[model samples]
Target: MSTATDDGTREDAPPTPTKKQRRAAGIAEEASGGIKLILVKLIGLGIVDALALYAAFVLVMHEQWLVTVLVVAVAALVNWIYFSRRKLPAKYLTPGVIFLVVFQVFVLIYTGYIAFTNYGTGHNGTKEQAVSSLMASSLQRVEDSPTYGVTVVERANELGLLVTDPDGEAFVGTNEQPLEPATGVEYDGDLAVSAEGWKSLQFADVLARTDEVTALAVPYSEDPNDGAIRTPDGQSGYLYVSTLEYDETAGTMTDLETGVVYSDTGVGAFTAEDGEQLLPGWQITVGFDNFVRAVTDVRLAGPLVYVTLWTFAFALLSVATTFFLGLFLAIVFNDMRMRGRKIYRVLMILPYAIPSFLAALVWAGMMNESFGFINQVLFGGASIPWLTDPWLAKVSILIVNLWLGFPYMFLVCMGALQSIPEDIQEAATVDGAKPWAIFRLIKLPLLLVTVAPLLIASFAFNFNNFNTIYMLTDGGPRDSNAPIPVGFTDILITMVYKVAFTGQTRDYGLASAYSIIIFLIVAVISIIAFRRTKSLEELN
Candidate 1:
């Protein structure tokens, strides 16, 4: 073990590491960590790319190229940020920003766009689509056309037809493609047993996709006039031709069967010479008409005024009652002498703990006019129209809302009360000031400082409280004078919902206009309330 080196050092002593060696080791460790990070980012980028590809496919199928491009571009940017080393903060923010743009920003912009157009049940999609739909509706089977056995299939969101020609030749096609001979076709009972790309739809599948199957039309060699294969039962295909023929050069749709001609009126629909219009017109922009109708339509304006006032009153009363009840409960429990305060607080919160929708349904059953618990048992069989009568329904809504909303106010007020300083209250007591005086003059102001913003938020929430009004009353106890199902119990939001969905005339444009107004009103009121709260803070 004892040996001498050339430099006269003992062989048992080890050589120390140099500065270059240490530096090289540190560099290698950092490179290893960087490689791991790159791998994780690459995996994440792959998942994002796959999702973006699927989304782009869907949007492109719907002819929304702009949205598809935006999705792809955003996905690319997300990958880029994660791939780059300098943009660490963006890695965390990209997903949330993408979702916000897709779900919130796009929805708001689309809603605003719809408000300026007649996009409702009867008026939807583009002009060419409307024409095709009109023609599809007026189709009749050709008298001499042969009946072909068929099977329904699906491609993307569209339906396809697998039909056997009279010669027992199988052809597979969709509305967009002409019927072509299909190879490798398996046959059973004169119909297609199987096709390579097409799936044979069962009875249940056909039933579920009845609309799509009914809308499907496969052309005979791309000539629509040359009778095509159509299916009503999704099993038997027939050759049919549109009775209504559209002449592009003349810009007129002629009914070949009736000799009636309809010309485009530049108002989104084709109108006949006799003033009759076709069903399912195309969407078209009508500047300010919907907005004007919201404010000036004699039919809607009258009821809207009453509903607006009622909405205000209802919101104000609900907040007032709930806050007072909750505050009283909080104060009672906050007293140090109170016994079992925690248990009582928990019991009080049970109402708020239950889902509001379920609670509304429960209340609705309990308040039934003839056989409900309140009428049958509590009132000794006296029948009362709790929901059918307008005034009584309004009262019932307030009571139910108070029960549901107070616990939230109670919890907030309790937290605020606990946070208030004990020193100020003790000093007031020592100065011989009464409890009510100290509370009203000093403690109340301090409490308001913490609770005022919440109160405003509560007021806004109640103003558009759709579920309570809808589930209990359905905006009913029907008003004969109103345009749509307006009643004393109906608030503005409920009225808007009724206009959009409840009636035979679903006017989405007007409903969107109403929604925009509601949004503006809420936003302005919130801003004003916050400013007032700030003033109160300044005064204090």
Candidate 2:
């Protein structure tokens, strides 16, 4: 449509969209959005499926049949849920459930399993593997062993020896399989150069893996009494026999030279009459023994008792000191008359803004006995031995923790105090209550209702505060007299870590037992604390 203005200029009007055209446009837009959503879903599911398939393949190769089945089942369930329009809730929940099962549940169950077994350095394999290891460790070369021409070969990533005897007969063997006659073995001089399906290692390859080539023990025959063929140089092999003979029927290992018989007394190792035990013992279940050892072992009991006590004291004192300091500062700054309150509040929380571990490390450096800022500057070069002395180390840890931890409590208390209504305090004051009475009766109870749970969590966190103790003192002023490596400042968690990782012999089962005990202690304490906090809710 066109209209003529007074100035004789023509004006054109825009056309309006019809109802059918609008509806068609809407439908097309919806279709495009649906297609996009489908593409996204497919891409996400494809990635998940790829990862799941890879994990399943690895599990299958390891012969973990049950775990492989579980993984496959989970992947299939995820696909079914995501592809179905009806399972919207399931699609949302599946990822979280899968992660929970994989990380938390699996680790908990495995730790519990290890806690009841002798699963440490020397007891980490099956009985058969232990027997093989024991035999291999005791192997000695025969007096008149015949040397055979040898060549290193690999098949399916397993190394084997291809040897040609003096009679011109070729044979091949690996650690798992006994020597068997080979057909179609290519020979150069008297050495077996290559086989039909095996890849022969060149001189460069053999030199690069000299240790593996030399340690590769090929069994001479299937008989237990027969010795194995071992190579010192890649070109020559010799027969070596084990000094100890294992009798499977009688479940005993006998020393041929000493005539000492070691019997398996169901203790995961072969023990002789003289109380000597053969190592590389198989893992076995010993229900409650680890737990009993923690409490009953003469060497560990004294340190355990003190460490447990110190752990409790440290947690309790950390919570008390941090809370009081934070609460006091929060109260001071929360006053209406306080000038520049915002700046002060921000300064108070600066410690919390930094990472706790980094703060602990900085404090650790500053608290050093001779070279630290605190000793050299603050104390005027006083050698106080803050970390080296036992009592002072504990105090130093408490001081640093308080400094690092108070800022968090300050922020929490500030938030909680702001949440408290001013009307309640005014009402209390009008009722003839003094300022202290008003706070004790009204503000404190209400604040506690919000912060008690946080305090309990703080206690739990400090109970296992490995970073502070580990970074500050490393639980040292080491107890030289203790049989195990323990210190006066060692808490339960740090003690567990030291026992499991720091020593020559890592006792994982005992550490796991300690971990279970810590869990139970924290659980019981949390339960009681949470229940007690319920009484504060009545003030609301």
Candidate 1: residue pairs that collide: none
Per-residue CA lDDT of candidate 2, range 1-540, in tens? 888988999998778789999997786555435877889989998999999899999899878999899889888988888877666668678889888988999988888888999888888888887887788788899989998889899998999999898898999989877899987888777677998888999989999999999888787887555878899889888999999898998999998989999999999999999889999899999999999998899999889889999999999999999999999999999989999999999899898888778888898898888899999999999888888899999999999999999998998899999999888888887889999898887888999999999999999999999998998888988989888889989999999999998888988999998899899999999999999999998888
lDDT of 1 by residue, 1-540 (tens): 467989998777556678999897776555435767678867988998999999999899889988888888888888777767566567678878888987999888887988999878778788777766676677788888888889887656667898888899999888767789886789887778678877788889899989888878787664444546798898888888888877777778888879889898877788997889887888999988899989999888789998999999999999899999999999999999999999999999999999888898899898999888999999999889999998999898998999999999999999989998899999999999999999898878888998999999999999999999888888768898776777888898999888888778788988899989998998999999999899668635
TM-score of 2: 0.88
Give lDDT: candidate 1, residue 273.
78
Candidate 2: misplaced stretches above 4 Å?
Answer: 1-54, 57-62, 153-190, 194-200, 221-224
Residue 231 of candidate 1: its Cα lDDT? 89
- Runs off by more than 4 Å, candidate 1: 1-43, 146-153, 163-171, 176-196, 200-216, 219-227, 231-237
What is the Å distance of residue 466 in model 1 from its true position? 1.4
Worst 10 residues of 1 by lDDT: 219-228
